[model samples]
Target chain A: MIHANDEPAVPMGLPLPNGKLAMWLFLVTEIMFFTALIGSYLIYRNGQPTASQPWPTPHDVHLAEWIGAVNTFVLICSSLTVVLALWSLHVGNSKRAVQYIGVTLALGCVFLVIKAYEYQQKFAHGILPGRVFEKLDSPHGYKYMRHVQEQLEHIEKHGGVNDKAKKACAELLADIRAGKLQPKDVNERVRGTKSIKETNPGKEFITTKDSTYVDLPERSRPKDAPMVEGILEMDTHAHLSYSIPFGNMWASCYFAMTGFHALHVFGGLVVFAIMLVMAWRGRFGPQNAQMVEVTGLYWHFVDIVWIFLFPLLYLV
Target chain B: MSEQHHDHSHGDHSHSHGDHSHGEHSHSHGGDAHGHADDAAAHFRSYIAIFIALCVFTAISFVFNELVRGGIISPMTSATVIMIVAIIKAGCVAYIFMHLKADWGKVYCIMIPVVIMCVMMIIVFLPDGVLGWR
Candidate 1:
């Protein structure tokens, strides 16, 4: 029979304490979860068609690498603080442990705040998955030509074409009237369209199609070009329609991986808050210092995930 | 055993057995207060060094990407180097920050199977997902 004062027998073949082993087991599940997510991302990324559906680069999506780098630094610093907190506890320094944990908590908040700002920017740009860009093969050229035709007609009605350019304008009108320049022909050459403001003082009031101007290159024609060309050139600001190929797929992966990771960070912040309270209450000392170390393990795992993610998402 | 229990319970009778047991275990390994302080100092310095190394790795990745963008280095080379650097950073975090180096317990026994499972998942999915076989 065991006496009241007898120490409890260690579990057979169990090398670690129960709490630590359980934490490691939990991390194993987490590792699998992230691995699956990242694996799927890689497959999708690698399988993308290079020519037809090229993946969008970081520039195409306006992802700021410096911000990501700063966040990485923040996380690394937080990881260091977490370890320091655990170290302080091991040395029986409860006040310093609480201070370190507090710093870690603040760093976590900074990371989330920065993440929230990035997400806001993405939303503002309409960069959500399935809506990253206009449909590939869209009839943007046809629409652009139709807008051109309308602008030409408006110039004719308003006598906007000067005498020096009337001849060229009439010739261009003949081409359109004779079906020489079909919508499909222009559509084939049209990549994308963007809105521009009319820069010429005289043409400022000349209403164009959709109340927007399309600026074509002035190098395409002479200085005293035709009315249509002149109207196209009047706008100094040219909006080009550029498509981000397979952008939806990229956005989906980016959001999923980073979103899940952010959630884990938030969870860690909550745990740190709790730990901070416990440390403040003087509950954490050499006796219960393992608690801080266990928590630090999870925090470090989060940092490791970000280390991989920083290069994959931001740098690459 | 009784004396050991008595020494642990002397100061922290309110703490649970789990807490005291862990404390006793670490203390057994710690030897004395002076030695424990020294170990903690070494750990502190190591953590600082690792943090600096991590920051440098992050900077290297950033600079490598910039070089690729500037056409000073090929994208392929930059990508390879950045990935290698990322893996090294993760390894450092796992090995040192996670305390796996100091405490090599059954955690690896738990980790090995999970690693194999992750690898198997990738292998199984690669064919259909990447090669478009199915």
Candidate 2:
């Protein structure tokens, strides 16, 4: 039977309807598109420098699992709505079709808004991608903790835990536990590129955040000596392929993948907006729903891509 | 209704549907409208059921993800289980919502290359695959 929305059967021997064939072809390309991206992610993640601690060590990145879960529900919910919209239209129920499409669009917007809020939180904390990634509380802070842990371990090995460095290590360890120092502290220490300097190990700040503090014994300075400052000195200009825990490879991969997916959601929203108006005008029903079906195909494909992305990035 | 007005505009065709015997009128409306309503309405319940299933799996996914983060399970094991659940969720969405279950047979032809490409991508990432070849 020739559907009102079905094209005159295609010239070729394609068994599928014209729109279905076209959508399937488009989906094929989309599959390959995501393959390139996801494949690159796997390669980069696997090819990281082999370390004793393993890749993506706990605390290396603090993804808000709750928000991610909420967004996942939103996407899945939107997929369900899209499905219902298609089915509703296929059953000669234009009113139900419009309602479902509207709900799907709303849920899609919710997903994007929550993602925006997540981005805002990360940005405030200086969690960004690539060269722009501000290591407010991530690899930078983790590195400091590891450094202090190493210093304490050294004292334990050499001086039987009674060493002076052990006391300093304990104080630093306290600072970490209390979450005393943050990206703000780092910025205050840096002040600007003018004040930012590469101070060596055991260096004290020129002006302490707390001046009345008892300086760690191992970090003592000579009287009348020129003032110095603190901040871990690491090469941020390292190549993406070489850096293990440093640099912003993880952030880069994350922004690239999630950003592209969000763009698709925006595109989907535009299509839904048009479809919502069309459905309101009573242009869609059981006899003429190929348009809605094709759009649903695209929406489902987007949902499928997110299924893999969520676990690979957040859960795994 | 717009449909009756449209039919009136084409007054030369006297039949109610104006469907030609040739069936080559490029998507002319067939004689029957809402003919498939019974079957579609019956299957509609399954759509809601699939939705409920999706929500349950979503909740399970989050709980399991939190457990993974909390170090209750090895990351590898957590990843495996999470991925399996994700695949199932995607399958339900595609097969039911996307109408893959009733889609024309040529869908297999479209899907085959996609699956092969995805598998090839995984193979290339394998430790002993072509990526490591000198």
| Highest-scoring model, lDDT | 1
TM-score of chain B of each: 0.71, 0.63
- State the weakest 10-residue window (summed lDDT) of model 1 chain A: A192-201
Clashes of each: 0, 0
Fnat of every candidate, listed in order: 0.60, 0.48
User: What lDDT does model 2 reach?
Assistant: 0.60
lDDT of each: 0.68, 0.60
User: Per-candidate DockQ versus the true complex?
Assistant: 0.33, 0.26
Q: Can you write out model 2's per-residue Cα lDDT over A182-223, one digit (the tens) per residue?
A: 533323222212222211111222332322121221122334
* Strongest candidate by TM-score: 1
Q: Which stretches of candidate 1 lie over 4 Å from their true place?
A: A1-13, A139-242, A280-284, B1-31, B124-134
Query: How do the residues B11-44 of candidate 1 rate in per-residue lDDT, one tens digit apiece?
Result: 2321344334334434545346555556567777
